[model samples]
Target: MEINHLTAAEARVWRAFARGETVDFRESPDEDPADGGDWGAERTLRAGVLRALLLDGPRQDGEVPSLSVAGARITGRLDLQHATTDHPVRLRNCHFDEAPRCYAARLRELNLSESLLPGLVAHAVHVDGILRMTRTRFTGTVRLGGARIAGSLYLESAQVSAPGTEVPVLQLNQASVGADLSAPGLRTQGQIRLNGATVAGSLNLSDARLGNPEDAALDAQTLTVGGDMLLRHAEVHGWLGLRGARITGRLDLSYVLLSNPGGSALQASSTAVGELWLRKAPPMEGTLNLRRAQLDVLFLEPDSLPQEVLIGDLTYTSLVPHEPAERRLPMLERQRDGYVPHAYEQLTAAYRRVGDDHAARLVQLAKQRRHRNTLPWYGRLWGLVQDVTVGYGFRPMRAAGWLLSLLAIGSVAFALHHPQPLKAGEAPPFHPVFYTLDLLLPVISFGQEDAFAPSGGYQALAYVLVLTGWILATTVIAGVTRTVSRQ
Candidate 1:
């Protein structure tokens, strides 16, 4: 880089690179360019000059060779692909004519905070320190895929817009970050993908508004995070897919407003998390899928559940807010993917683990009813009988009620109609209550039942009483056996 070819702004940046001082091009120290406009030659620098200074700048014994320029308008492309630099680059509040391409470049810290750029393509780049892009605005896609960062990646309050594109505006696919990917208050018009990305620390996206209504707003399939993934108060217009993701800590989505009508609002199938916080979130417009997801603790509310939920094989060890079966059973019933027995069984186990036996029985009874709907007609009819009589062996009191009612009917009928004796004087007295009791108790003879023979309507009543007694007895035995076997 010759001194004669360098412009005034580039010359100043060149002089300040080794001194570790920022070259502020604003009219005053406190002046901030609102839209990064109204810049003349005094605030203009060729990107090639900046790149040359970073690559081959003069360094002193104790000075760190860094490029810190603010409020400058960079022209041309800053292509540093496959390049290596030991300097920390900080281009704050700068405007660029072309997007900076640092693909496969290895550097120290790179901070572009509050800058206005066309885009950034740093795919496969290795950053030794933090990659800060806080408050920056990008008009095109910011591709950081396959990048390995030793420190955290900050995108707080950054806005990226790339409409009418099938690709994501912000792509971090397969990137490995040693620290957190903190992006609170981040707004994007297109999808933000983190597919197959591995973060050693937490991924915080609190209060982000991701807008991709026709498709997925955020696709993080197969993402592995060592710490918590916080998306609290975030609003996603399209489906937020987290299929096969594994988070070591909690995945908090409290107070989120997801809208993906006619599709799934959140798909976390096969995801495993330590804790899942979905409390106080409004009912989503689409399905909340948790098929095969495993969680240690689930902080959810029945009223906050979406209309269509796909919790086919979701297993949670503990549920917060500790609601009863009446409130939680509806969540299992709302699964539109037909009858899932595992869902009911999981809820039953969850209740039972907490020593809520009554709630567990209620959930088990609901499981029978849901399973009955999938059976054949005859099986369903038999199930209905079991349900109405004894709640499919879960409500034993119903059997007792039926038995007492039948006993009362038989006693009253025999009290009204007296039967004739089979023999003239060898027959015992026809005591109605005793005779009815004898007729109702199968395999038991009270001697009066054998001595007296009923005629006409009285004979028909005895036959009905005997048949009812057998049915009630068999049902009671079957129900009690089933209940005891379960225990």
Candidate 2:
């Protein structure tokens, strides 16, 4: 390709490429292309000319070969598929007529900040330095699947929208970023997929607004992040699927608004993170599934809780706010499944770790109550009896109180009506308290019971005392046994 007979803008770009100088067409750095400026052939450059300059450009004596064009219009498809370029391409504030195709291409660095592009297809592209698109707008899908970036991939304040399409607007599936993949304040109308992607540093998407009403807005299943995955204050209209993801650092979702009615808002099942911050977020519209996920610490607030949650086998070492069981039990009660005993047990353990034995006991009691709801009527009745009598083996003082009450009742009844002696003068002295004790003891004979015989109602009363004594003894024994076994 002869680089002669080029337009003024193309000639300037060719000259600047060899000299490593930026060819900015805008009067001001912040001026956009649509800000009342003529953008005809005077400011237009064919993509092929730029591609030729990058591939076979004249090298100056001392200056490095680089392509930096700002506030210009690129007319043709910048197809650099399978091509290798050593130049750093910075096309800031530019408008592209067609999407650039950099499939399987190797480049030093690429920055498309503040540019308006129809789309991008850079799948399997290798960037030695950072791949930046800060404040850029993409009207079509931005595919970066299987790409490897040695440095960070920045997309801060970028807006990507594929209107009326079900496909992902930004695809980073299986892409490997040696450093951080920061995209704070990103806005997208379609899905943003990062499935199986690996980020050596943190992956920040704070203040992002992702919308995909039909499907998941952010599908990051199996994604691995070495540092924190921050999504604080994000608004996700569709599901945010993080299933099987592994994050070495904390996963922050504080103050996020998730909405996906009748479906899962956040599907983080089987994910493993060091810490999970879900504080101060409003009530979500859909289920928050954390089934089988494990985290070192879980920062959750009562008001941030969703209507339903799947916490079966979700192991978290600690809970934030350190609230009492009364406040935390409500969260466990919202389990998606009918009743999950593991969630209650996990909450109980968390309380115990903080040396809050009272709170731990309360959680244990709540667990039993929840479990009782899933049983048959007869079983529930039995559970209720145990609960009312001794708090299901958690309140031993209730047993002591019942024993004293029964003792007093038996004594008063026997004292009111004394029994007749069996063997006249040889009978032991009649003591009402001892007689009542003898009837209630079941095993021990106080001699007063053997010496006298109660007739009619008194005899019936004595039998009633014996039956009540047996019941109390059985229940007390059961409670004690359960308590010991738990300890």
* Candidate 2 per-residue lDDT over residues 444-464, each given as its tens digit: 888988898999997998888
User: How far off is residue 418 in model 2, in Å?
Assistant: 1.6
- Model 1 spans > 4 angstroms off: 28-34, 443-445
lDDT of 2 at 7: 84
lDDT of all the models against the reference? 0.89, 0.90
Mark the 10 consecutive residues where model 1 has the least summed lDDT.
Answer: 29-38
All candidates' TM-scores? 0.96, 0.96
> What RMSD, rounded to one decimal, does every model reach?
1.7, 1.8
Query: Residue 309: error of model 2 in Å?
Result: 0.8
- RMSD of model 2, in Å? 1.8
The global Cα lDDT (0 to 1) of model 1 is 0.89
